[model samples]
Target: MHDSRAVPFVCPIDHGVLEAHGDWLVCVQCAQRYPVVGGKPVLLNEANSVFRIADYTGGNAYGGASAYGTAGDGSRGLKRLYHRIVYTLSESGAGPAAPFSASDAVAAVQAADPDAQILIIGAGETSYAGNITYTDVAFGKNVRCIADAHDLPFADGSFDLVVACAVLEHVADPARCVAEMWRVLKSDGRAYAETPFLQPVHMREYDFTRFTFLGHRRLFRFFDQIEAGISSGPGMSIAFVLRTTLANSTEHRALGAVLHLAGLVLSYPLRLLDHIFTRSNGAYDSASAHYFFGQKRETAIPDRDILQFYRGA
Candidate 1:
């Protein structure tokens, strides 16, 4: 169970301590005013981020309606059905097993300190046990607060473990986001990240970047790596490419959806090949996604040392 009182909120601009005053949190140092929406603070740096605090407080975030449809509109079921279809198509083949268990990492941190404060960036619908704080750019049922990765609204060294799975690719400035992750973590605190390498864009405008295995490792050079390797292998890459290409071939939404499904059905079997390909060193070059788990260090790993860590053929 996450306790909201464990971590103190801070102003995104000056990292000043915030005190609640009516429906707003006023910074003690900078006196910046941030709104509290539905009991959750909308602590965003408006100048630096694309999102404005008014977007949430004024209810214009999703244009006064949910993007995925609402229960009252009767489109919730359709939205769910659409997601199911997409999942069915994308999960056709046997994909590579994740290199590390996120649950295991949580357990490890908890073992050392049962009350360890954990932060999950881009948490989406995922939930974890213990003192966890869930944050995302968009508000959701699971999200405790709305925050931007580029400028996190927490005091320095506030968290014991920071998880950013499937998030780096969406940020405009991944390096800056990683730096913020590093900033929020306590000294020697652990950090985990999973990023796509060969997968095609899915978030449309939100998707901006990808990283190879070594590149992903280099991104967190400020931390000493605990483990780093392919989370999804070349097989997933092939499946996604085929699906995207076929889907983009037709302008009609219905036809494109059908083509996408067909592509998955035709290419799913190839995904099993990941089991074989992942065993080879060359798989690093063509992996669909990679994960890195590291502990924060005062000094960054040298670039020359990072180059020597490459394993691709």
Candidate 2:
């Protein structure tokens, strides 16, 4: 439900309003033109432009694309296949919790500020219509654009809501990204955001970070309201690592599918087992993927204790 044309966007350079100019977007104030490619606006600043996801999965996805078959180190292909299996597992309600992220944060923000202008940072390769972003089924015209988190094109204080989902982990400088989010929000506006509290190796072009609950709280010290939600725990972590690692092995994929099916069949019973045996490892290691949000308030100020306690960037 993001409407790009509803709220006027400002130029990051001169704080000027922006207008769409053919293939490029122009800032009315500074006259800077940012190209729009494949419907995504590239708004990176000079300080942080080139971003890449780390090779967490060993290039399995890309390597396995050849219809003829794979050569070289097929590790990449395996990784890709592993993720495919993971998604399948997610669809079937198998493996650990589904990879929930800033998408939920976006919904939370929308709930708080229905008519506020919104921007999605690191809006990478995702479609707002059919993808995770607000679907036509959810919001009629809610979100406007999915722009890079580090380089937001809009002028300062132009957007009412900003969502930086699991994107901060990939950025070279998370602090700078947070500062930019703060800069773009109105004095009294709030941003709904979340980062992984517990996650494994992920390559979003580059996965450089992870956050603890306290760490997440600390990052949004500039906001008036900061609340942290729990995320994945030891048992779930083990399930993810086991399933992914097994799925990555050529010999184990077929086995992994069988395992996944077995997991699903046993899920209800295991869950019952978890309930009866609360002290068991599976029961003992439960955790929810944590989410935290902060609202910008004009008069309300940050507290020294919370700032000092959770200050992690």
Candidate 3:
């Protein structure tokens, strides 16, 4: 269980300091009560967010539900099979080697400050250190808090490192969410994110956006680039397109599953092409995904200057 007091949590609405009151956290400014479910605080601004605090407190929120399937025991076997197919399809072709190590970033931050506050937004079964706080939109086994990325429920400049890996695409407003991330980070703090570019939609309704290498850099213009490049290559993009196409070809669930598996098998060889594609500068035009690791800066990069930094062929 996380010690809430250790975290610099604030009311999402007014950004006010909160006081614990029985089973709730009351905002000192607005006096609005937010529920503490189990041990994690469901800190959502009900008016601004699509999710309601009541959804979590009432145990109605569905954590990690994808558009592909429902969360039920009866579909567990099918879901397992579907996941296996995806894993096999994505294993080899997903991308090229990453330019930087995420773990190394965590270690460097910890080395700088042993008691550093690290926040992982949309952290799904990813835990880096004891000092890190894991937050998601819904309750999960590893989630320390339920938070909306667009309006993070934490004090400004409260964290040393903020990670939003593979999360921005799912949010309705990536820019606003990124701004919230910038807002919560201390001066010269670090931000790391991985967002899809050429990938097919998997999370269904939850997936909202995609960004190219240049677009990804533009998104984090507020951060001085430390290192940014393709995390997944063109091979993975081909595999994803094939699989999604076959899977959605028909309304028949059983047949669609079989076709999806077949797509994976058919595209297996094409996925291996990433080995060559990732080495070419031209691959940036069709790269599957991009990653950005940067530090917070007071000045945003000008649009014209950002265009000059484009590496695509």
Candidate 4:
């Protein structure tokens, strides 16, 4: 980065400080080099960098690029416009979801430094569909670094804010990913994460874990709770289940697509129920996805406290 305030990154492989060595980020200790492509540091460990980059840069980036979409601007504009309305209700459920709607995460970060260094985990191109690409409004223009969420390459307490939307489930170790995010944040820093609770598996097999509303709270128990609640309502969850059931019942990919499309159309109206259902007492039990936002602290979350956070399905 040209600015002196740029967040200097460490080497994820060895956790060693790295310096700009031509077009590479060279670790001062191991002398290993991580390539910088298109101004973004490829901070992933060697094991992931090789395979993941192929998909991240190529047109089919399901390997690990959740936020980063595949190439081509083909229908992105139309997709964004459509989802802007449809997705808001389906995922949000009820009145308003916390953390995901969370300007608080940004507020907490901005409180420390107006030009705070915020890091977005799994920041990459939009998905293969381009519908989920990064919005400049949410992630401000100051975000200058891009790296793997699981293995962040930054000195301890370097960032003011970290946001991971729909990313934890993709990583093999969500705990490790959270810990890494914590490690990079300043004590006053905050983090926001979102994950599905009842939604079907997505992003191929890369999709892994789903958490209860309370389970989501416990995920970031290490931090002081700013807010956490349903990001996507239960209506969307039921819709996905319907789509999944129909898709699995048939072997024909084309027919499966038709069924899923039809399911979504029928289900689209169901989300209106979320305005009531998401606010119901059983909302957490049937939530489509959840969001958690909190601030970092010095004390560790107690194991005993964690055990008691479940609200159940």
Candidate 5:
């Protein structure tokens, strides 16, 4: 089904239209044939995609590469499973919910045009909405194709709605990624994104940067702001920082994982405190994450004027 839905994908490197060739999407301009895995096209610009589950798993279905005598993929099966369990139990994650929440994003696209062709960036981990078409660097649980945020695989002005939740911090260059998102959107299309601010290093070395309150606005300078505010407040920030500090401070990562999970039991209760602090004036200073809901505009935001949007210098 997803293979059939992937008819409009283009090449991220050259923007060439792609046609389905057997189990692959072949680019017309470059003749680059991308393989389809599990009905989802793998359209990553790089042959070795970091998000590909197979790459990390060392060819195992359970993703336990340590058992296979591998260490370069960033995580062993036990470590990966440890993080997943902690995240699930604590309910602290970068998905389309809390901290980097998805409310504004889901609301904007659905409200503006429910039937619009929507492209969801970093959709391998979770689904943004039932009406969305998902894409990521590799086919995961629900992704429709392989796409990188820094270079999209869709044509210019091809989409009516674009949603990227908790994805910017993972990309090497946040500004270029946002620009790519703006590029794929129609003149009247809308974009919704969220990123962490006070969280600790996640996804290991892949976690590159954290933005201040104003930094998020400047990232989407080309779009008209519809709503921009804290999704996860100071309390959750305290929880995340505490738990991660405990987990990463020690040399023994497996022990650290257990320590962090135990610590999360205390932190999980702190989520409720977010209800109070999210409305505070200084939420920007300590909030865990922020969301940006904006509409695309033909005119780009002048570079010099971007400084004016800076909330913290």
Candidate 6:
């Protein structure tokens, strides 16, 4: 269980301090609940039916986790280089900032101004915390981490910047999620969001959809300035295709365990190839993810639209 005093964030659905309950976290507010097995929150009930939670819990992540084949030492190497090469390639495609190191982008903003108030949406355990690792030691204490994403608990225009990573894909309505982010952001604030484009079925506890680069651009149209691009090289696509093919085999259920083990071994060599072939900038034909940064333009408030207002005014 997390030490509440240390984290202090409440659940978005229930607004209660998340308390550990039988391998899950139960909220006292709405009583809406989720699991925390393996130290990762199981945010969606739907995941229980579609995924093998037991397999995930047993350290058989190669079979049960997202990107089923990228768990072993060998596969991990390949996956890392795959992301590195792809991200490097994406930097050359478009935008002010380079595509490499979201950690750097995040750190750059935090370091530029000491008083910059920031918001982290879908404040999951890993990605958010991981970003903080690269943050300058000077600004670490000033940041706030909120656990809720669906309905941000803060007042509107409360922050100078907002960051969301790999989050919209898990929400029921990506459009609504984008709207909420826009709502909380100060008129002058900028927001950064990143998500996968073509990847495996892992992170499916609440996984809803993936975006094409163009689709991401459409989603962020509200912003005055938006830059959308992809991440990871072609090797990731190769890995996805191979595993997906195996997963659909007629005898999959029977041979899944063996195949998963085999995948771990294969992932290493594939990762090496990724480094060789994907080291330079090229068109994102094989980009596995997408990211965008947008600056809010001062505009009329959206929620107070004509539909809800009196026509006589």
Predicted model with the maximum lDDT: 1
Residue 287's C-alpha lDDT in candidate 4?
A: 82
Residue pairs clashing, model 1? none
Q: What TM-score fits each model?
A: 0.91, 0.61, 0.90, 0.78, 0.80, 0.56
The better candidate by TM-score, 1 or 5, is 1
lDDT, candidate 1, 1-313, per-residue tens: 5444667778989999899999999999989999899888999998888788888988776321123323323445865676566675665448767768567678888898888999989876668878898888777666777888988999999999999988899888999999999999999799999899999987678788999888898999999988888888998899889989998998999889788878877778768889898999998999999888899999989999998778888
Candidate 5 per-residue C-alpha lDDT over 45-71 given as tens digits, one digit per residue, 9 for 90 to 100: 764334543442244322221122222
RMSD (Å) per prediction: 3.0, 8.5, 3.1, 5.8, 5.7, 10.9
Off by over 4 Å in 6: 1-98, 127-148, 225-228, 247-254, 267-282, 299-313
Writing each residue's lDDT as its tens digit, candidate 3 over 193-241 gives 9899999986667788999899999999999988888888888888889
After TM-score superposition, the amount by which residue 130's alpha carbon in candidate 1 deviates from its true location, in angstroms, is: 0.1
Q: Which residue pairs clash within candidate 4?
A: 68-124, 68-125, 68-126, 69-125, 69-126, 69-127, 70-127, 91-232
Local error of candidate 4 at residue 148 (angstroms): 2.1
Candidate 2 structure lDDT: 0.51
Global CA lDDT computed for model 6: 0.51
* Candidate with more favorable, higher lDDT: 2 or 4: 4
Q: Which segments of model 4 are wrong by more than 4 Å?
A: 1-4, 47-104, 124-146, 307-313
Candidate 5 displacement at residue 39 in angstroms: 2.2
Lowest-lDDT window of 10 residues in candidate 4?
Answer: 129-138
| lDDT scores of the candidates, listed in order | 0.84, 0.51, 0.82, 0.65, 0.71, 0.51
Where does candidate 5 stray beyond 4 Å?
Answer: 1-7, 47-85, 92-104, 128-131, 303-313
Expressed as tens digits, the lDDT of each residue in 235-303 for candidate 4 is 777877886787677899867756665666677667667777766657788888888888898887786
Q: Which regions in candidate 2 have their CA more than 4 angstroms from the true location?
A: 1-5, 19-22, 28-31, 38-40, 51-85, 91-113, 123-146, 247-288, 297-304, 307-313
Off-target runs (Cα >4 Å) in candidate 1 are 1-5, 62-82, 91-93
**Cα distance off (Å), candidate 6, residue 5:** 14
Q: Between the candidate structures 1 and 2, which one is better when assessed by lDDT?
A: 1
Q: Pick the TM-score winner.
A: 1
